[model samples]
Target chain A: MSDTTDLPAPSLDVEGWTCPAPLRDRPRVVMGHGGGGALSAELVQQIFAPSYGGEALSQMGDAAVLSLGGARLAFSTDSYVVRPLFFPGGSIGDLAVNGTVNDLAMSGARAAYLSCGFILEEGVELDTVTRVAEALGAAARTAGVEVATGDTKVVEAGHGDGIYLNTAGIGVVPAGVDLRPQRVVPGDVVIVSGAIGVHGVAIMSVREGLEFGVEIESDCAALGGLVEAMLAVTPDLHVLRDPTRGGLAASLNEIAAASGAGVVIRERDVPVPPAVANACAILGLDPMYIANEGKLVAFVPREHADAVLAAMRAHPLGTDAAIIGEAVDSHPGMLVARTGLGGTRVVDLPLGEQLPRIC
Target chain B: MSDTTDLPAPSLDVEGWTCPAPLRDRPRVVMGHGGGGALSAELVQQIFAPSYGGEALSQMGDAAVLSLGGARLAFSTDSYVVRPLFFPGGSIGDLAVNGTVNDLAMSGARAAYLSCGFILEEGVELDTVTRVAEALGAAARTAGVEVATGDTKVVEAGHGDGIYLNTAGIGVVPAGVDLRPQRVVPGDVVIVSGAIGVHGVAIMSVREGLEFGVEIESDCAALGGLVEAMLAVTPDLHVLRDPTRGGLAASLNEIAAASGAGVVIRERDVPVPPAVANACAILGLDPMYIANEGKLVAFVPREHADAVLAAMRAHPLGTDAAIIGEAVDSHPGMLVARTGLGGTRVVDLPLGEQLPRIC
Candidate 1:
């Protein structure tokens, strides 16, 4: 793991083990379980077991563990609160699942089970809740995992911000997995997971006032498969990072600081569809620092960059994957991007409020 | 554990357990760890070990198991938020630790370690935060457990309802432990850990508009010792319950319903300090349903009732402990109280609201 990567490829065999218990067909989530009493046990016993993926996890115990086979595990948690509930690509439920799973992948580990805690507003439609949860189950299945166990609490309308989803993930980083920002050497190459600003632009277009009529759907999808492809080909990945809230620029700057290395990104090498670029221009927003729900940045050793990118772009999820920059020792702990005209500037964390609650 | 009769007994041994790594002097919690990142590791490294108790708990794993030599385990999570942060006799910090410990104790489990999560509003006074945290540490020490690994997140101001505290506990109920509601037999006796309503009234007195001066203070202290005392005297205790939110009345109703039995209470046998009664009268509040942060209600076998009560009263923390009622098959699933006037009526879970979030 190095400073410039967001999604790293690491080998892991999470198979064979399975949870035999099945999910009960409860009409909907009842208040009893959330009340911290008996009903909660039934939910855990029935619904939780089927989706949990393993007997160890289905034990209804407090936490989870991964048999990393003597590997260091990467763990991460993210809470999703994307408004408009339903979106072009997915809902908050699915997003929550993929987002945390992707985070662990970025750490060069095989993502396993996740703990989901949902804070739902009291009046949310039961159908809507079921749909979102089903979406989560579907996404978890697609990524070869399970919903496992969860906690659902409904707050009196105002106290809750509609729906808040907290997802914590555990991934096993294999024995030979070496990932860190500090691995970003002077000549390391940077690769973009796909089109950089599509996800962010798509979100902005749906905002109350920034209504855009174009087909700008968020590129939100689980990246574990794509990462698996890359790892199958190369395990010596540098740093993998999801360019979430602060986007590409923030991601780059953080990597630089973390690795104590300098980063040089070429604006020309970055891929941005005309519609996304145009939308960013119209909205006066920098695509580099916008939030991207389904994207990650990776810094890899230069010699293996082409092979890694080729492995990535072969997957449908990474058709637009491309090399964006290289890591250097100069400007240590900072990032300098060469604009279209070769002009360089620094990218930093947001100075003030930039669409608060975007995450 | 039974509905209210099974009082917890502390383990006499504390040897041959896995010790955790040394603690770090982490000054403040960083954001990345809360992101489910490596920073979270730093937190676990620096803060968890020293304060953490129990071999199974110190591994910093998801959940721990007790050798109990085969004791059934009871787990519970509680979040504490008391305005003014500190009240007379106890602070939210102490209350947070004690509250869950008691819940686990009530379930007949000898509490081992606690996992605490703090949601700190940004820009909170450093001194205040540290003090509150230190108080938590000190109390855990007194209770003979480690704080264990904890998660801390600094939400932007106003996002929090003050410094919120969530503590999840792990305890082992000895092999023969069977404290479930069903054990509330017809002649079982009910014993309280101490006086009730004192905690709720103390908070009210400190709050604005309900201002009244008296020597009344919170009775918020861990009841593990007292539980152990009673449990040692009588292992046949049937049920153990903490009368928290909705207070004694709500707790009684819940127990009655859970055990599919009825409970009869004698008003004269209940213990209520004169000051708490006066404050409730002045505020037009009912002392019966007011919360008690530190007390518990225990139901013991008739043969052991006197011995358990004597043992409870012998502990300083349970000086006011008293036998207040008897469980019965009559009035199935209801709580009937014989008032001072010799009349009995139903006491049930409030139809709607009854002092929300008292703990």
Candidate 2:
């Protein structure tokens, strides 16, 4: 774990958070606080976790697995604030449904129902709201989950972006399926499903009005089916994570830190689409640090690696899945990439998002 | 249902909503769409309901009751955008927790877990966020529920109010309890747990800088315990509703319409705090149209009315509980209130909120 010896002493009192000096000397909330990076992790660890102390919250998983009335349930929530309501492959509507579904899927659950909350800007066209809602309804149908309950609130025109949607989902975890970062061991195999950086690059292209030879659309699709295929191979998979905000690099760092295991990946084996690679190269962005909405990184036991890879490849969403690396005993809690040029370099968890609201 | 003879024909083969001409010539969402009144209902029936098209959603209860994994569950969501964040006796944080809890309680369920999503404006004080988190934590504890999972997103400073919170709650329904508006019968007795209009007046006083003779603190408390006590008396109660947003009038109208029953309430028997009544008189607002956070309106069988009121009064949050009305066979699908001067007046749902952002 990163050293906290230089940090101020934490004061656990009932009043409020008065200890653990403000992150990076910034006492006010910055955009990075929502970037799903180091700043986001710090905010949870220092403020939220301490205030809302519980074993479930402390687990720090994509979704909280709870035993309720003899049922193993997975619950997750996400808010979509991506600017420009519609993107190339999907809108905030798709993300609102599929994002929460993927979070539960990462916990080895199939989502049953979702609750949607809409915060609309007053004077927004009724037509725009209709399009988003229709998209949301269609996405839920595709993911096999129902949008069962909802709330709508409108803010005066200037107080909000056109639309912000929050979806909280509930799912049932099949018996004998257990997933958590702590289960990762030194010999664990790391695999990624499909390409990275396409989503972030696509958002950038549209937001900045850049022409990159060929059009790139977000690889945004629900990953529940892919996850189910992998689980069908073996229920003993160590961990599964959807690399959305901080991308594959962030997910790897989180797993390494939580399990106290080092991760080493072969740079040449990591998948990157040609269009995304070209756009990132021109923009000076690292594909590893970019976001992917419909992709996942998995840590599986070495024994089940080949079989799981075969299962993933048979699935449509995972045709390009590949085994890129493995966990190691050296440099616990750190990630190192074996470069294609026969050298190695450390891949640190991003401090903040290189592309904000890409999801 | 209100006559739809003059409404435009609905086209189900939709690219988008092409039916029911805009509400009263309005082509865009207005403040009334969030006011929990006629406009809010129209938005749901015309747009959200048709787009979503699910049985649970069509039930239109405070929470959706579902059966998942052989267990009965109540799921609900609400977004809080109250201005000033802090109000008398509570803040947006308290409502974020208690509001969803009460929604579940209205479904006769004890909330087990809640998922919170925060939309923060960039540049907001960390201290402010801390205080809100603390309040949320404390409120969850008071209600005996866990804040299990959460997500946060940020927008530039101008794009959002200080902080908007959306909470989705999951609760387990007791074995034999069934509560819905459709169950109300002509002879059902109407009872309210406590005084009305205090919450709306308290918010208005602070928001408008009006000094009433006495300080009216919001009656904002979790109603799970109160609900449990009432259920202990009889799980056969016809319906339960928290008079929030459009308040008692809106709730009564909904029940009347859903069950095809008429309601007649005695104004003298309706418990209204003197301060709240005086404030409403001066503000020219009707107590029936004002909101209450900690109170509930219940339609009980005439035979069990006395027992339920006694059980409610025995609980701390229900000391002022009173039987103020009854369902009647006359004037089906309408609400009529008897004034103290022996005159009857029809109480219609407010077109919009008299006080917006009052939570």
Candidate 3:
């Protein structure tokens, strides 16, 4: 376990951000704000939701649930700007599919269709584009969804990365399944679907040119099947989240804020594969704040926790699923973790991501 | 009318395209390739469609129509990369809402909800973003649609332009309205909603720093309400298309190709506001190939042409709408225009966009 005294302050100004603070407190967007942390939350609440005002925008779920005609549907969109298009086990294409699918799945929706929008940089190899498309198609097939529609735009060279992909997904939420962060309650069991931090570490390994002497492939797989398995156990799941940008700590913090509940977890109970642990130790990073593409953290009522965990473990994507913590009445909207040495330390949302574009 | 002797060959390689012609003809994407012209069609049919194949993608309509549960829904997406985020009558915000709304409207769907994904540069002014968002909210209210969900991503300053917005829309396709390109018949009449060239001229006036004495504001208004008005006139509206990138000529050519029919139009009958005509004449740009954000071309049965024209004219957006052309069997999958001097000329899609990033 990481030493509590040696830990840096949770809040720190992000480096390499050159935007002028135009607003009173902060005028420009910082990398931490996009890291799905407190800054990101403030951005959405203060800017996006107020500007794009609607009942749905205020819902603040992974996907917005809406009723069209008499049927309920989940709609979501995400833009992927990961630096290296291809990493150890996945590419931007896989992330595009899995990210949106997981989002819809988190809402207890069956991801049925998706739209792929590609912004290709001029002079990119046709072969490279075809490869990414193939990966996208394969990932969509794996997730049991179809690429229903698409648009393409090209930018001048040097104006864009090699390629950026935006995917908008539509899924059907089953009747009687209502999942939202506010549904989380004190005494709800918090479960991690599998080993965390694999996805972020994998990207960093390739980007930073570090060799951990062991290949740490990205856990960038679709979690729809695992989510479906859990739903099969019960539609009463309180909350579900895929820790992507700001990692497990951010997701837990968001839920705590949304539900007005406190969360306490055992540091050792969170599953971190040996490779990820070694990488984090060497890099002086915390696995709790590292992103994970394929993993999910579920908040379930204690009574249903056992059944859900069994169902998740039975699925291929959740072999390492573990119950890491439980919601508490104390310290509402705060998160604390018990260290391996039996010391309790506050686990705050990182001001910004330790790694940028780790998605 | 352009002199026949002065017309350049339509098949020449686009200048500044650096890729070698290894896969069929064009190897790299030219500006015109994204212009919704023949090049855009090839990119979709040969590249995107083949790569991301599915039943819905093969439909190739303005939006993908899918039956989710018992409700039929129209889904569409578009990315706005229009330079100079703020323009005369509209900004990227207005374009983002209206463009996707228009896409859904073209399919005879009343746009209900939209998803916005913004890729912002790090150093862009917060005030600029807030202004754009306000414009977007206002436009959505005008169109009777809600911005339900949104995503924001910040890229490093040099890697991106100030901002690019992508909106994906969902609308419920009403029963009994079947609108698609393939539904156009040989005797169909082509009706354009409002005057041509205003939008393109408006963008160019600001971008190129030119003025034509009179201000040319973009016709960047949502066409959904106008479409609903037409649908009330008749549920059997044949085909609808917003002439955006690549403009009217590209749209007519695409409809021709899709329906396997020929189109013939009276060049003088097509309405071009005097300001736009003068601007185009000075810029040496064919008004036919310039972009429009708030205009649409409809293919309707000749028998209903008069009634449809009346309905379109009654709507505020279509007050200047005019019947520009007709479908014919003379030259299958081709477009021709009759000059006032009694000469007929083939109208070819531009090899590349004359203006890049003009929405």
Q: What are the lDDT scores of the predictions, listed in order?
A: 0.62, 0.87, 0.84
lDDT of 3 by residue, A170-208 (tens): 998988899998998999999999999999999999999
Candidate that scores best on lDDT: 2
Off by over 4 Å in 1: A1-192, A213-215, A218-240, A263-275, A297-328, A338-344, B1-191, B211-215, B220-241, B259-269, B282-285, B297-332, B338-344, B357-359
List, residue by residue over B1-359, the lDDT tens digit for candidate 2.
22453332222111212132357466567776777877788888888887775988988999999988778999999999988799899999999998999999999999999999989888787778999999999999999999899998878778989899999999999998899988999889999999999888989888889988999999989999999999999999999999998889989988898999999999999999999989988977788888888999999999999999999999999999999999999999999999999999988766666676767
Better of 1 and 2 by TM-score: 2
Residue-pair clashes per prediction, in order, are 44, 0, 6
> DockQ for all models, in order?
0.02, 0.47, 0.44
TM-score of each: 0.62, 0.94, 0.94
Runs with alpha carbons beyond 4 Å of true place in candidate 2: A1-24, B1-24
**For candidate 1, lDDT tens digit of each residue in B44-88?**
334322222234324222222223113344445555656668877
User: For residues A1-359, what per-residue lDDT tens digits would candidate 2 score against the true structure?
Assistant: 13453332222111121122357465577776787777788889888887775888888899999988778999999999898789899999888989999999999999999999989888777778889989998888899999899998878778988899999999999889999999999999999998888888889889989988988888888888999999999999999999888788889999999999999999999999888889888887788888899999999999999999999999999999999999999999999999999999998777667777776
| Per-residue lDDT of candidate 3, residues B217-261 (tens digit) | 999999988999888888888899998887888888888888899
State residue B208's C-alpha deviation in candidate 3, in Å. 1.2
Query: Mind sharing the TM-score for model 3?
Result: 0.94
> Candidate 3: which pairs clash?
A21-A27, A22-A27, A23-A27, A32-A352, B32-B352, B32-B353
> In terms of TM-score, which candidate is stronger, 1 or 3?
3
Model 3 misplaced stretches (Cα beyond 4 Å): A1-23, B1-26
